[model samples]
Target: MNKNNLIYIFIICFTLISCGKNRIKLISENSNLILPKDFKILQNETQSTGIADFEINIMLQFDENNFQKIIHQVDSLILVDPNWKSSNNEYYYENFTNQSEPSNIKIYKHNKTLKFVFNHI
Candidate 1:
C-alpha cells in the first residue's frame, strides 16, 4: 500500500473509534429531575414508614436553579419504585401554615451545597 492509502485507512479507523466512544445516552423526554453524583435510589417496601405501604426515595444534591425548578414542579412530580409502583398519586400538599416567618428567598453563595429531602407521604 502507498503512503497516502495508509494515511486514509488510519484516519477512517480513528474516526470510527472516536465516534463509537462518543455514543450519546438517550434520556427520557419526560424526566426533568437530574440525579446527583454517588446518590442512592432506594425503592423497597422495607424502606417505607408503613403508612404509605411503599416508597421511593432519591437522595441527591442539586443546584439552585435545579432546586427551584423542582420546588416549582413539585406538585407534578411523581415518585416511582423499582417495581414501577407509584406512591405520589395520593400525595397532597399541606398548607404552609406552620411557617411562622415569611419564607425567605436568598441567593446561594459559590460552592454552597444544599440538601433536599422529599417524603413520599
Candidate 2:
C-alpha cells in the first residue's frame, strides 16, 4: 500500500504547517486531503495573473475509499458555515461576514494519492 509514500507525505505536510510556511495536515491516515489546522488557507496554488489571485491544489497520493474519508472530514468543517453548498460532490464556501473568507475544495483519486484541490480567498 506504499506505506512509506503515505508517511512521507504526512511528514512533509506537518513540517510545512508547523513552520507556518504552508497549509497541510492529516484528517486521517487513509485520507490525503492536506487540510490546515482550521481548514482554511489564503493562497493554495501560487500562479500570479494580473491581480495575483491564488488557487491551492495539493496532491497526497491515496485511493478512492480513503478519498471518501477525506471528503467526510471536509464536510464537517463546511457545516460550520451555513451558506456552504455541495454541488456534484464539490463544496463551495464563503464567509461573507469575516473578511470575505472563502474555500472551494475538491477531491479526486490520483495515480496513488487522492488529490486535494483548495481555493481560498
Best by TM-score: 2
- What are the lDDT scores of the predictions, listed in order? 0.33, 0.46
Which numbered prediction scores highest in lDDT against the true structure? 2
TM match of model 2 to true structure: 0.38
Residue 73 of model 2 has an lDDT of 64
lDDT of 1 at 100: 29
Residue-level lDDT of model 2, residues 1-121, one tens digit each, is 5999999999999876674444344223213234432333333343343364554454454445555665676677556646445566455443334343333334433332333433334
List RMSD in Å for every model shown.
16.4, 10.6
- Backbone Cα, N, C clashes tallied per candidate: 0, 8
RMSD of 2: 10.6
lDDT of 1 by residue, 12-115 (tens): 99986664333111011113333333322221112454665432222233466665554444334434312111222222222222342111111123322222
